[model samples]
Target: MFGNTLYVEKIQHALEQSNFPATPDNLYDPVRYMLSLSGKRIRPLLVLLGADLFNIENIDDALPASLAIEYFHNFSLVHDDIMDNAPLRRGKEAVHKKWNESVAILSGDALLVKAYEQLAFVKVEYIPELLRIFSQLAIEVCEGQQYDMDFESIDSITGDQYIEMIRLKTSVLLGGALEMGAIIANATLVDRKHINNFGVNLGIAFQLQDDILDVYGDPSTFGKQIAGDIIANKKTILYILLKSKLEQEDTQEFEDLLTNKAITSDEKITRMKNLYQKYHVVQEAGELKGKYTHLAYESLQKVNVTEPQKKELYSLADNLMRRTQ
Candidate 1:
């Protein structure tokens, strides 16, 4: 089986070769620009890896579906940046910032349409099931985004609600991508469900890792602005866990810090990090990430594939959890 490097290169080359119309520059340019940004491409990689797990001979058959997942992912990001009013994406100007919001919205809509267009090229036999999976994934992602926005307004949320939000907003696409590949490879229904479960659990772990990294990772390698979550007052696991552990006085103080407009962004980040350290939220977040990662491995173990066939996926999951970027 090909390793992750080869698969990533294949996906990159396919993206480079993707055809887009020239005349409608405003509508299509942001789509192209968004795709051009550097990303881990984890979701598309899941599709390819899922196919390989079943000993699919020509992994190229999975490319259209992979690209579909990618396009849809970028579409979400473009709109998400707008909603978050985030100025940067991948450390560059956001689509809404580089172009106008109108162009970004139209381009994002076009990317969703392009995702469906890529889905059309899947093997005829698999198209119907792929469509069904893709549609459900799309709706779930929207619902997850809505939940994320909703959380911003609510003062607090349970850890379970936070996990469910990330699972929907982020994890389901990973699960759906793997399921699509399994369908294309004609894997049995049981294997498909197991692999999807693996991806979902793994994706949750991945996002939790991200939540930690957002606060503590090296800005040069972490891709986006450091301490972004703290700056946005996002209700991350760290935030929730810290809040739960704080004394009554400290809880009120923490609320004051989050709403304090007088402090510099740097000051806010520093204070938040200090509070996180004091409360041991980072350590607790690491523990939670470990829990999900263990769950992912358990699911992966249930897949009906040979030990050798599972090596690459196991390696990929390890690398994902261990990644600094």
Candidate 2:
């Protein structure tokens, strides 16, 4: 987190050293401005930490690829906001809302290109492997976004499909991120594979936790309304799974609650959520999330890294799984 001095300092140092200009007058100004907004920087830090975990002395050798991952992530968010018609991001106006969808989309595309530009800086010895993994992740993220869009239009979607969608959209990048770190350090194939597995499994748990928080987290901590997902009728795991739990009459009642042509904002929030609670859906979601978290730890333990190094990763994984956001 930015609260940590090393994490904050290294990222700041990386941004400062970047060839990207400082003046707000340039077309790329927004890129710098967006980066300056000071995110958690967890993804890049994961890269640094994972590399260091292998006792690699030259952390800088891997930093460019690490930053490329972060840039690609923000790029996805920019386009995603437009697709979702979301008004805010990180407690501020979304890029699409602040400017226009056209500008937001173009800016997002620029970020995507810049991610590869940064990747060019990664050491040549590792670039080929990095590109192979990174390209797969990039394509899968787009596929995941498409799947999410498909869910909105389709009436029937399996829980398996939902998991696959999020795995691609959200989890694969984290896996590639750690994998990139291992590649830069030239870690053993087994260690690299294990670390990547850790990242992917943790990512699944992270998104599931996000779904739970959307329906139940404290607003003060969440920075958004609890139950916002329910109001939108988003096909979260809780919603899809509980549809099977309800009896015929209860299913009809639930459908009626969501089928309103124009649902009253308050009623939408209340009815969908209370019904979720009635079905104990959040509890079931937690069970699924915990399973993934345990699997992440299991994979992490297989890595041949030192205990002290693994300890930090374990701590980070615990925080991520427990975080309300």
Candidate 3:
């Protein structure tokens, strides 16, 4: 089985070797630039890990599908950055901030096309199923983004609703990546489904941790601006839990604080963190994350692979759930 380091190096090399046309520099350069940025590459790693569980020798067969997932992810980020009007991605200027919005849009569209082009490299026998999974995941991610936007305008959302939104917006792609790898390796339907479930559960836990860390993590280690979600008044799990525990008067006060644009971000973050601490919302969010993470491990245990073969994935999931960045 390939270690995480080997898989990371392999995916990095493949991405570096990816062929893009030289003409239409405006359209392609942003795609190239976005790909060039440093990211955790967790989705592709999940694909490779999923294949390795089946003891597949020619792991290279999974590369195209893995790259397809990666390209699609970057495509979403480019467009999302434009929509969020975010100034930075991965601690550097976002594609839209670095270039004009029109160029970012065109490049992002080109990336979606490129993702399909990468998928073409998969063996013909597996192409149909892989495409089906990829297409379905793509649509679900869009729906998730839409739900996120809709929640921004709505007055309230339940915790269950928030979980569903994250599952669609974030978890399905992780699940699909694992299933695609299983398809490439000719794994049984049962094993494939189990692996997909594992990825989905883990993805949710990861996102929940992200919500917790937004307010609690050290800015120096987080690599991006701290309290960005708080600054924007984005409804994270912490906010949802805190609101659920507060009285109507307190919840109204929280809303007033969120809407008071005159207050500095530091002030808002301080006030919100105080409320979160007062209500033990951070501790509650941690418990929720632990629940999903435990579920993920249970799903992993259902895979048919031997215990020894599962070590790498266990290590990866453990690290992911504990990450601060």
Candidate 4:
């Protein structure tokens, strides 16, 4: 029930309320702005939920590590937007859009460093695991970014590559976040691994759902334009899959749209979406998302969670998998 999740929600709300202006007045303010943006606070919520699963007293003891999770997530987003030249984040101006790339770059770096500063508050016993998980996630995120950039230049990409890219770029952090929470809660190793797998499969389902939404979500609810990925020629799950499946003329039209730098956002989005429909892109993406969702639920069922708790968690997973945007 929502009552059970209220505690995690409160921790997230408190974390946001505790925000303060960045120091030195001239620096790190941009990173601060990115942090201040109205993000869903999902990562921190995961931390609290992970801790609560083990009946950990005073989840606040995990607050610093939880904050680290958020800081690192925002830091990655700041740099990611710059690389993607994305103009908006959380439905507002992106950090790179608000400031010059140099400032954005420096501030993003500071955020990463500051993430470590807060992470130091993890009790001495948790330091090694924290460092190991953080380092591995950091590296994987970079690898994912590189793979994404690589996709821009390649003529074609495989479904496997697309899945791995999203796993690295988007899912690893989710897994790491829950694992970090388990580590802080001092859960059994089996439980920690299971929870981590839960996060991992959940992430795959979440990303695949996003891919499905990119072409089919309601425009108003989706925030961003539908089929925006197709317009950008981004190597999304749908795009790569459709590449090998669409008719030659259909493929050429999609490719031609991408080649045209002059196409309006609305026009490009419309054409790509129309073609996606003609080729059954949305259905294929939906099926892939379902596969991941089933896998995620299977992983969730393997944990020690009581049925009622499992229902609550399943509700969350259902929400993620079924989101419009």
Candidate 5:
């Protein structure tokens, strides 16, 4: 079984070896800078793992597809950061923050084009399916973003709607990456579908875990601002659950906490967290995460591989679910 560590190293090396054009510094420099930030390469790792599961003869053959996913992922991040007006990424200046917004926009577009170019390197037979998955995911990502923006102006959103939003915005890419790898390995249709489901479910749980961490994770290790979601009223799962459970009388307090500009950010977080505990939303969110995590494991089990062969993926899912930061 190929371990994640080995695959991570391989992905890292391949990304390092990739060459970008030198001239037109404004355009290419941000692309280089964004890649250099190097967040967890989880999406590409899924691509390699999906291919490996089917006993693909040459892992190297999948490198282009794997890189394509990474490029697309970074491209999404660059634009998301700009849209979010996020100042930091991986503890460094975000692309739009480092350069100007216009440059960040152009560079992000370049990354998206580069992703298609990488896809062009795949075998001709695999290209059609890969493009289908990639394009569908790309469109869904945009839809998810639009929905997310729509939610900002709306007062309330249901739990199912939040789940669907995260599924499109974040989970599908992970699933698509796995499917692309399965295509490269020439996996059976059933196996491909099962593995894709596995990645998608795991992604849902992963994002819910992030929701839990945002309020509760230690600020020092959380990477981003702890309780940032709460402060922003970002409609996280926890927030949604809290809204669903909160007493009608307390809804005013909730609104006050979010709208009261006079309170310190820490005070707002503490009060909201206290309310979260009072309504048991935090525990409820954890249980929901566990439910999806279990579903992910079940999906992985349907992949037609032996139990021993699934151990590494099992371990990967376990570590991701339990991660504190």
Candidate 6:
């Protein structure tokens, strides 16, 4: 019966109390620093919400899984920043930039270890299934990351390929978090499958929303540089759709503009936005996001829980879909 705000507070308190070795400042400090950064904490919240759906009275039972998800997420961010050569994370200095790449790598590894350590505290009966799912989730995320990198080197990628990549990299973890919570509550297999599907579909929608925001969102609110995808020549859904819509000459121009170093970042962003608007790809992307959102709702509705029990998750999904950041 607790709301999202209370659940978030509980997660924050647990993170604050997490134990880390003090002497090896270089190794552990980056891990601590990365965790301290501002984030939505949506993944962990899903863990609690999943358990709450089953009417689990003592939410504390879900805390270990929540912490595990958070730790793994932050660990991914640390390494992802390094891979992207991103100087900022959560609008502050990135771990690699603040410290050094080697230290950041070590710290990120340490965080992954910490994530497993947290998983060790989950209820004994659920441990085996949780470990299996968590391990698979971890491997899939890596596959997604590798696919993303592979796309960077290629000329074109199908929308299906892109969707699959994002699913593995982003959506699976969300599903895993919720499923872990359901496992802890001893929910039936059918209910677990339904909730996990709900989360996976919702996560796809969430990432699509992110693609839109990256182009049009306010920099201050978005928590990252606007048109960063454009600058990096990322094959976002918008870019992919736009590429498909462009004629041969327009496609050539598009590629040239992206590769042109003479243009300033602002100029590149402005020009790209013009192209996106001209092709109406943003609207198309919105429609694609809506498709996944509908699928998510369908999955949630199929869950055995009563409508009243599902209200918070539905509200959270709505808010996430509408978010500007």
Model 2 spans with C-alpha error above 4 angstroms: 1-4, 21-26, 261-270
Provide the clash count, candidate 2.
0
lDDT tens readout by residue for model 5, 86-171: 89888899999999899999999999999989999988999998999889988988888888878887777888899899999999
Model 4 CA deviation exceeding 4 Å by range: 1-5, 8-22, 247-251, 260-278
lDDT of each: 0.91, 0.82, 0.89, 0.78, 0.89, 0.90
| lDDT measured at residue 116 in model 6 versus the true structure, 0 to 100 | 89
lDDT of 1 at 35: 94
* lDDT tens per residue, model 1, 168-286: 99999999999898989999999999999999999999999999999888898876789888998878899988887887767766887788789788998988888889988899899
Q: After superposition, how far is residue 226 of candidate 5 from its true place, in Å?
A: 2.7
What residue runs in model 3 are displaced by over 4 Å at the alpha carbon?
261-264
lDDT tens string, model 6, 1-325? 8999999999999999997889699998898898899788999999999999888868999999999999999999999989989898988999999999999899999999999888889888889998998899999999999999898888778777888999999999999899888888888999999999999999998899899999888888876678889998889999888887887767766877788889888888888888899999999888989999999999999989899999999999899888764
lDDT of 4 at 136: 90
Task: List model 3 lDDT by residue over 26-95, tens digit each.
Answer: 8888888999999989888878988888887799999999999999999999999999898988888999
Q: Report model 6's TM-score to 2 decimal places.
A: 0.94
Candidate 2 structure quality by residue, lDDT tens digits, 1-325: 1223575477678876767655433346656656666688888777877787787778778789878888898899889989999887887788888777777877788889989888789878888888898898899999999999988888777767888989998998898888888888889889989999899999998989999898788888887776877777788998887786777768776887778767786877787777778888888889989989999999999999768777778888988877654
What local lDDT score does residue 120 receive in model 6, on the 0 to 100 scale?
A: 86
Q: What is the TM-score of each candidate against the true structure?
A: 0.93, 0.92, 0.94, 0.89, 0.96, 0.94
- Clash counts per candidate, in order, are 0, 0, 0, 0, 0, 0
Q: Please report the candidate that would top TM-score against the real structure.
A: 5
Instruction: Give candidate 2's TM-score.
Output: 0.92
TM-score, candidate number 3: 0.94
Q: For model 3, how many clashes? A: 0
Q: By TM-score, is 4 or 5 better? A: 5
